[model samples]
Target: MAAETDRPAPEALISAFEPDRLLKQDQSGRRIAILGTIHGKQGILTAERAAFATESPEVLKAFHAAITQVTNLGDNDIYRWYLASSGGTNNVTAAAAAQQPPDLKLNLIWPCTESHIKKYSEQVVRMVTETPEIYHDHVRPYMSAKREEGRLNWVFNILEGRTEQEDVILRDEGHRGGAGVAGEYHYDDAFLMLPDLNWDRKTMGSLHLLALVQRRDIWSLRDLKKKHVPWLKYLRQRLLEGTVKMYPELEKDQLKLYVHYQPTYYHFHIHVVNVMLEAGATQATGKAFGLENIISQLETISGDEEAGMADVSLTYFLGEASELWTNVYGPLKRGEKPQAG
Candidate 1:
């Protein structure tokens, strides 16, 4: 396991922030970007790293009470966004502010830097065509190395009930009936759903959820096989039903289900979002593959049950910093044998 690093809470960092300017804001005003300085003197040569402060009880109360002005941005179904302010009347005292930021509710990117700014900002993206040969020869190996390096420790922490237990929306241990029938289902089929970190939990329009499988045999969508169609269908139905049940305002049709090809982590998980949410690059064609489409392909695929996505060619984009790009794809583009991850 990678040694965990001790870091300050977002509240502590926010309390000591010195505002410079609003860097950027988008996502229909659901998010904001600000550039600011902190009082840390350790990194004189390097730019400060960024941190995020979460909403707390005190901050949430002030945020709700300090609305002196409001400008409606737009709405999707029952969801609404606005640009509002407290008219600066609810400002905290200097002493109070100095100790911890005023009663303000805002996300922070503390210890941030110019590099992070560029990373978050838009940049040119290139698409790569990944044939089955490329996947077998390169991508699979790279994924294995990443997993071996303990990159999935955080995922295991959640699965093992070591962290974020309270946030779990639903956990299905593949139980269909009494204990006698439990053996009929594979243990690997067990999964749990949770609110994605990007979600504020209150925004119905921007609803984003994740369903992470308990099994480790399947790393990415590429590992899915025709035999798993039943499991896939079962998962899809439960996820959709569970989300709508959690928020009575949403219908099953309002949710969109998909999985990323080159997912951020190697674990098998599905991304469920409100259809009304804006389709960003994360939902782009080369990245997100619809669960329904994938299932249909699997059902009709001309092969034995063992045949699956591994036999098909997949195309997607990779950041320049990605290990696959630096060690594999980049070398291939230069007409050299790709290096191992």
Candidate 2:
């Protein structure tokens, strides 16, 4: 039997969130507000929220559901990796922050700079398109959905808050589903903020994340290129203005805006994160797209049919445990350490 010390109790893994008491909001301002906490065996999967402090509650809810599936939660060690930060990182003093490489210095995607980013992205695009069975099904179904009927629309109604009413630290024009979420887009502007707060609002590891949702249908950066830059411009403006309104403690220079290429969901959402926090460690790397680099590239792009989305090369992680690595490229498996980028 595993020693008691080897695994923390499941209750310790989650802090402010209770799956049953969780509420949902839909069109017309009505809510599916359940108000009670349930616990027992199923509570184990809440680990990722603690691990990826900035991910929206919708994203975290989906992750807990996916990981706990009998097939997905295969290796126990891997499960612990996802549970790395339940206790929080608040105790790390500022002096320790200097010892680590700032997330800005890291190659956000495919950490290796040579040919990995392009090659990895190409492999993903081809596989997700040509051989989708290996895609783990997260690539999204917009390709097969009926866009005419408004099915599979991301921005129409997606940003559901993960925490309870009193736990929210901030909410803005783009914020949806904590208490008030109307089906129609209510904000005249395109920015949103939700501080992904744990039960302990003061937890050191909490991510005061904000998102800039574009007015257009720009899914992930995979669909972005030179022509789609006006959205980037708007994102920059939102980051500047929203930071002041919500996080007066931070400055424009101390914050960063990032987009995850293999974002948990499909939406052209820009992440506004505090620069001092080591939020990047939660994301495996390669998946985190630097918005600054994207804006710079957008400014230089020449508008031509040929110079389109291809201009934005990218890479997403497909670990050996993933169906893509196991079923599609089974022969390549040699039990190497997961690069995680």
Candidate 3:
């Protein structure tokens, strides 16, 4: 309704929300979608309610008072809790449960339009086979252009401590426990570990984390060279060890570390997730490449320091609506050179 700087406080807007209807709810019951409006807003609000972060104070306090039903999703330590009123009500009536709102996961989009809703809706995905030639000739240029457009400002914001600093679990500023010589690693080689937005942070089985390097030169895994093998190995070990230290309930063996071929951002980052987490499209074989495998590949590659991931082919899937598909692969599929945006 207003410029971001002039927008009302989230608490004020939330208090004034009026739900028009329930739009959808995922089968896991962890997410619920709704169409609604703020008390004074002119346009609809597309909002979603998800499970609260497990470590949140509200969840800790409410866990004892409002839990009416605790249904085990499976033996994998996933459980869904149905909350009743905050008064510690013993009456387990369906109507009472229905009247109570969900716990504290609210993501709101105010003044939302039909186009906004359509953009977020599901889309078709197709598998893409990318040869080294195609990557060097077309995709690399597309990636460079996209990066020049400042798409990674948010990532830089976090890395520079301009925002989301509280969410960082660990920050390693280029020193490998003082083991290496000075200048062996560049100053920008610093990396940090933080929770992924998708994680609830409390579920051991659903743990998701990210390790992002600060250097701007390496755009993705492709930029990794044999010379960077030691750095990669250090990153993998630190990510695993740091996570285990931060979350004692988890062990090194319980974690799965990988890197995405076509990362959402053009930054070299590793995805650290729990082994018990469901293997969704994100973890699918075509999309995720194991860190160990990459290490082994680099160790055995023929060339000197310059030999790297770019020397090989990579196959992955792209959403039909993605710019890569629209501007690159789609054109190539028609027997044409990939077009630039």
The numbered model that scores best in lDDT is 3
CA shift of 290, model 1, Å: 0.7
Candidate 2, position 91, lDDT = 69
Candidate 2 ranges beyond 4 A from true positions: 1-191, 197-206, 212-216, 279-284, 302-306, 323-341
**Model 2 lDDT, full chain set:** 0.44
lDDT of each: 0.74, 0.44, 0.75
Candidate 2, residue 121: how far the Cα is off, in Å = 23
TM-scores, each model vs. reference = 0.66, 0.43, 0.67
Model 1 C-alpha lDDT per residue in residues 1-341, reported as the tens digit of each score: 23345566667776677667665443523455567777753211113323323368887676567554454443322223444443355377645534541222233344444534654665566678888898988889888987896667768888888767788999988755432211344534689998776565666777899999998899999999998887888889889889998999999989999999888779999999988787898998889999999999999998999999999988898776566777888888899888873
Q: Choose 1 or 2, whichever is better by TM-score.
A: 1
Models sorted by TM-score, best on top: 3, 1, 2
lDDT of 1 at 73: 40
Query: Which residue pairs in candidate 2 have backbone atoms (N, alpha carbon, C) closer than 3 angstroms, thus clashing?
Result: 16-199, 90-204, 108-286, 109-286, 110-286
lDDT of 3 by residue, 206-294 (tens): 78899989988999998989988878878888899899999999999999999998887799999999887778888998899999999
Error of 3 at 107 (Å): 4.8
Q: State the lDDT of candidate 2 residue by residue for 36-62, as single tens digits.
A: 443444432211111343358887675
Worst 10 residues of 2 by lDDT: 73-82
